[model samples]
Target chain A: MPGAEGPVGPRTDGGLGGGQRPRDRRRHILGDVFAVVCGAATLVGVVALAILLFDVVRDGVGQVDLAFLTSFASRFPERAGVKAALAGSVWILGLTALIAFPISVSAAIYLEEYAAQNWITRLIQLNIANLAGVPSIVYGILGLTVFVRALGLERSIISGALTLSLLILPVIIIAAQEAIRAVPDSIRQASYGLGATRWQTVSRQVLPMAMPGILTGTILALSRAVGETAPLIMVGAVGFIAFTPSGLGDQFTVLPLQIFNWISRPQDEFHVLAAAGILVLLALLLSMNAAAILLRNHYQKNRN
Target chain B: MVPSAPDLSFRSGRNRNERIIGAILFLCAALSTLVTVGIVGVLLTQSFAFFRQVSVVEFLTSTQWTPLFQDKNFGILPLAAGSFLIAGGAAIIALPTGLLAAVYLSEYAAHRTRRILKPLLEILAGIPTVVYGYFALTFITPILRSIWPETDVFNAASGAIVVGVMIIPTVASLSEDALSAVPDTLRQGAYGLGATKLEVSTRVVIPGALSGILASFILAISRAIGETMAVTIAAGNLPNLTLNPMESIQTMTAYIVQASLGDTPQGSLAHQTLYAVGLTLFLITLSMNVVSQWILGRFREEYE
Candidate 1:
């Protein structure tokens, strides 16, 4: 009503300004274009990922029979299986988890629950962040010098696992800290008021509450360790081990290393085998991630 | 009601256990610290040994990198340049696309859209870098060759594109978290002033989330810089000091990998050079991470 007043300006055919309609139309068109562009980019990215997965699955599924799962690498691509690599991955994952989990969780607990506001804690926190960003290859070199060469561990699973454990420790610590920090302070106070000791309160109460997050983080970190190639390569993991590792001290090859060896070969058949290896690796990664997701979901449901 | 004989003995026993557990936790924290210190010590020691044989000037300034040659030129410039060019190209391709996708996911998309999009995006991150390396070598390189016949079969462009795709999820996920952290009140205020949705989002929300966005970008850059397998498999092993993305190039990580393939003799200058490169890569990434954490710590207080 105020806009229509004669004192303000001459009357127009509509309430909108003469230029407003075209501007609004232009904006709507621009918005649509923007939305379309964003949607397309996202869609394209997802499609590329899907295509990669599809190629791997298509090529690898054919080689994933029981024999392939159980047998060692064969002289022929047709006869080759992932038995050695699978066992190596399992061993590496088991050892890495064993080494990294306790240390990472304990560090997180200390930082989140016990540590006072002080410079030492700040320094430790800063170092953890920096460590997390160091390249896997750098960790590999460290492993080569410290574990494999300096300790004389040779090209064994122990060195690989230890290197991987170090590589993933920062990730686990960060994630565990986040989980611990998410716990409400009221629970701690309640436990303290009941005359429960700090250990009892943390282990039975805070830890149980943070279990799912910790597990998820550990699983994700282990998954990353499984896929990692650089550190293992540096730690002297063999590329073409025909026999399965007999023990922790024996030389081993992982799926990624095997795939690299195959892909680097001049033969097209080796390329196919590499694709198949990728599928196997993807399956392993997906299963582990799915388990983590399930655990997290279960925890969330019970937590509420 | 009188609590007759107080349970002081039991309480004291429990307190002793708690102290024991606390000691164990402290040990674990120390262990985590030890891992960091151990890595630094081992890398520095080995690198120092390498530097004794090869002058820092030669490592930093030499253009040629034919370590296997009789002449043994050990300049790191070619690998460093390759790493920089590939990472820069990846950043150029990933940044705008990732930021746009993040904006859509955090600002414009509905909850359902976001839920679907986020996990789909994460699938990109989960794909093994080795698989991406294969994709670059096979699919992307072939495509590039179709357009540019002069392009090498193992070209930096293919590696850069695949690496960009590989990093998009990381950038998008972190940036989305950043954008979503911006307070709603500022957005509401913008809306009350009659700003359009796009205007409110770009002008108000993005500015509010600027620090987080910058952190995400820095983190993405760090990841790109540290990436190994994809570049190793896609970019050829040739350490050429050329700027052409269509040609084969080598990264620092790739050179480390090439050195670790059992060709370089132990205690040789080339072997030690790997550690030196590792140290440089570690320092670069660690500094980025420290800067990111510092930024987050400083700015997070302002928001909270």
Candidate 2:
């Protein structure tokens, strides 16, 4: 008890008469050591990330010249690039955004602004949350059964897009809901007082004010879609392709799938290509995240 | 009087347009719900079809998985066991490291330190899992092999380690959010009672955020289970029911990928088995997600 109380108090004197002071100093030293250890561990995580990025950028940027962006993957590594993958990724992103954005925003709006607090709304909310956690692979299974086989869209980009759309729908809805919820009620009340309909208030005032946040959420969801490989693989992304996909019905690959294909091969050179592909993928993801962050910051600033 | 009558009619037309927009928005919400239902319907139907072809006992209990071989044994146990082992190993590595890092960042690190560390940790998350797959195959596997010569070039240990690293960001970010949510008043009260910083954090704050922490861990496990590319790339496609982490193993996702990539003749028993395994994986992750949501909803500590 005496030793405990002494350490709890500040050490004003260098030595408070022998063993007690040494013990207190030892405890302080231990605390400092623990702090250093914790700090070092965090530093190590940062360094690991730095090394990863460095390796990716060094390898990927070199292969990211005009031809790399313009041409398709070939039988040889020297001729292989991410043209088809890039195009497929863009088509998927565009279609997913188109399909998910309006639906998610509307669902969020209905939940946040219009829907009564009833069992129906509760069921919708619960389902959305559960759907968010369902594995991407499961979505792929769904896509394979429904869109690919049932609808006869077999291994096409549209099926992949729809699958990705489903995968990110919950994300967009959640984000949209948060953004809508953050809009001050006072704004809504003021519009209501002025004889504006609920639709008018939402579209003219609420949606505009919430635009940045909605956009942010959309971008973040899209970023996740960009890197998604499991669902796409499940939905039947081709491992090798020599031509860019001309339509949604054409077989396609995304950057992540391309990276997966290259890395899976035994050749060491392909590993380097995988690293390069990762760099390109990372660049796309970072830019998307940056857009989201910018939008979030803008909205936060405006709110204040 | 004539001009006023015309203006009134134009305003009424505008109101009608507003009503149309409102209807469209409602349709969008309905579409989102329909998409979720569609996914569930499709997966269930295919999975049911798969079940009809193979007895549940055979699918669950068989040891060898030679779906494509002439002697074709349809037992899914080896793949399931391998998935669990790799995921379990990943959890062991991820949980401790991620939780410790969260504790340090939230309780001990300075603001400047947290600022640098948080985004750096996210960079790990941003690195696509395919890249992690390559890193595991090329970098970590070699290092592990040097220490354990018996380790297969493609083994569960390397896959688990890389997967754990892939999940660290997710666990750290969520746990940090939970730890930060602990009220400052609790810390102040603990300090007033002469508790150490470590004591205050470990005892009060951690306990206060227990539900969130639990939720985060569950989410991490769910992610590990759903993970495909890294495991598929690093862990060889051999579905052996061995407990050794240094041996080649296959996961449910990997099995699905292998079956899909190979000419597993659609409508064959082997193809149906893929859906059966997919069904099992889906159920496990879905249940985990439901548990997480239940824990989060039931135990969230609301602060004014």
Candidate 3:
């Protein structure tokens, strides 16, 4: 609370026009208070993040052994592990990436490279932005209707993956578009000068240049998909399962759902287990993000 | 239709490949349209069925949200209230914190500090909501309980706080871009008038970027409203119309999960309510998205 006053609290206010204003004292106090408040507000993010990471690591470090990674759900808190949920999450991630990547990248290519500055293209652009902001839970309902029941996929990993793909498609597309758009026009002209076809220019020149950015975006999108629970819950991610999924058609529970089940349990031990599950989930997310950052940094370096 | 600008196709051997690729990409671009249609179509069909079964008055006017209860009260107000409770608290926490962070990031931070802090915030943003949920349930609630005994474990206060942390990056990063986008000339003019750093930032920068900042706030609010996992875990599932953030409540998104997570019959009223809630969620977010887009466009045109 003491630090809430902050280092930039107008401690050394220079005289305005070599004379203090009529309400100089009041103005100084007000400015100091305002800056302090803003500084404190800014501190909340950094502080909250530190505390979250510290707490999760401290509480969950005990549960990081191979047994915890290899076992499935158990009635006993000590015995419960994340094997089935982890496998299901991997399956979902792979499938969601497979379903979403090609479509999103190709869509980005078409919109950025081929589409004219026309009303229809503008509408599609607007729709993509809107879709990016649509609630993930709504996508869950769409999946429930289209994939689970209408398409008759049931509570399968594929249904969940497809749902998440839609949920994150807008994000991937927008990122990919930005990535593709960043490719210098001179490069395209150079490719054309070599007598390449449009497809050749796009696939060979544009895509190669944009690959790192696209991969970064895709990895980040997939990281988001990994942490998502609501859509999967709506898409019928089971809370507890005895066996790992063998195929896309099998019923599944992802890590978040598993963690959710643990947190909802009445026992204190379960809460601790939830902490452990969170650590694992964080590990997965952190690695993906680290990869994305490295990829982006590499791209920036190459661009420079 | 072929792209009229054919510079890249100067020596197309086997134009077949280019046409096929172009057609596929076009279809890929059109998938977004299909997704929009599918979401709207799914929500409407079931919402109509729900309206047919349950009177609109009962669905709108009543204060209870017990669609799955034996008595089966279908009032949406309670759920909306719950959603608003957490979302409003989230807004309260996020707006000031996020906006302030944005100000600091844009106006105050040095190059190295910016590099470190920005990526740290990205990590915060990258964190899964479910992990935040666990943090809320296991850590934040207990801390709040110590401060106030009456604060329940499954109260909106923790959910709101965590969701606020989750959104700080959104509000900060977007609004920072907005604040920084304010022409440096404006800040220099204020500085020439002997304005302090605090005054220049608070008055010149924030006001110059007001629309963009407003867009960020609206987008963050919509994100809070649509957020599911953290809110669901931290705010318990009991729909009672109340303004208190300490009370147990079920949000619209949570209800969708509760209804569908169980094996609710495909044609059951409970199942239909899922779509109705999805429709409501979709409408709320879609409108916010439109408003955000309009505000962002105004901001862009103003500066550009």
* Shift in Å, residue B121, candidate 1: 1.8
Candidate with the greatest DockQ versus the true structure: 3
Please, what are the lDDT tens digits per residue for candidate 1 over residues B1-304?
0132488888677768877877777677666678788878877888899888889999899999888778898888998898988888999988888888888887778889888988888778877788899888877888899999999988899999988998888778888888888887777666555455666667887788778777877888888889999999998899999999999999988988998995788987777878888888877778887787777777688678
User: Please, what is the whole-model Cα lDDT of each candidate in the order they appear?
Assistant: 0.83, 0.81, 0.86
User: What's the CA error at residue A189 for candidate 2, in Å?
Assistant: 1.2
Candidate 2: tens digits of C-alpha lDDT, residues A207-262: 88888888987997898899888888878988788777888799999999998988
Better of 1 and 2 by DockQ: 1
Candidate 3 lDDT tens digits, B1-304: 2444555455254477777888899899989988999999999988999999999899889877777779888889998888888889999989988998888788877788788888888888988888888888888888888998898779988888898889999999999999989997777767666566778887888899999999999999999999998988888888869888877788888787778767778788987888888898899989998999899998899878
Clash counts for the predictions, in order: 1, 1, 0
The candidate scoring highest on lDDT is 3
Q: Judging by TM-score, tell me the better candidate of 1 and 2.
A: 1
Tens digits of per-residue lDDT, candidate 3, A157-213, equal: 999999999989999999999989989999999888876778878888898789888
lDDT of 2 by residue, B1-304 (tens): 0123456777687678866776776666666667677766765666688778667788788788887789978788899888888889988977877877888898888789788889788778867678888778877888999999999989999999888888888788888888998887777776666555655667887898888889989999998988888899999899999999999999998888887777767777777776778878888888998898888776664653
Indicate the worst ten consecutive residues by lDDT in candidate 2 chain B.
B1-10
Query: Which stretches in model 2 have alpha-carbon errors above 4 Å?
Result: A1-30, A58-62, A293-304, B1-23, B301-304
On residues A28-117, what C-alpha lDDT tens digit does candidate 1 reach at each position? 566567767777767767888888877777766776778877877776988887888888888898899999999899988988877778
Candidates by lDDT, descending order? 3, 1, 2
Docking class of 3: medium
Q: Give the lDDT of residue A188 in candidate 2.
A: 93
Error of 3 at B259 (Å): 1.0
Model 1, chain B: what is the TM-score? 0.95
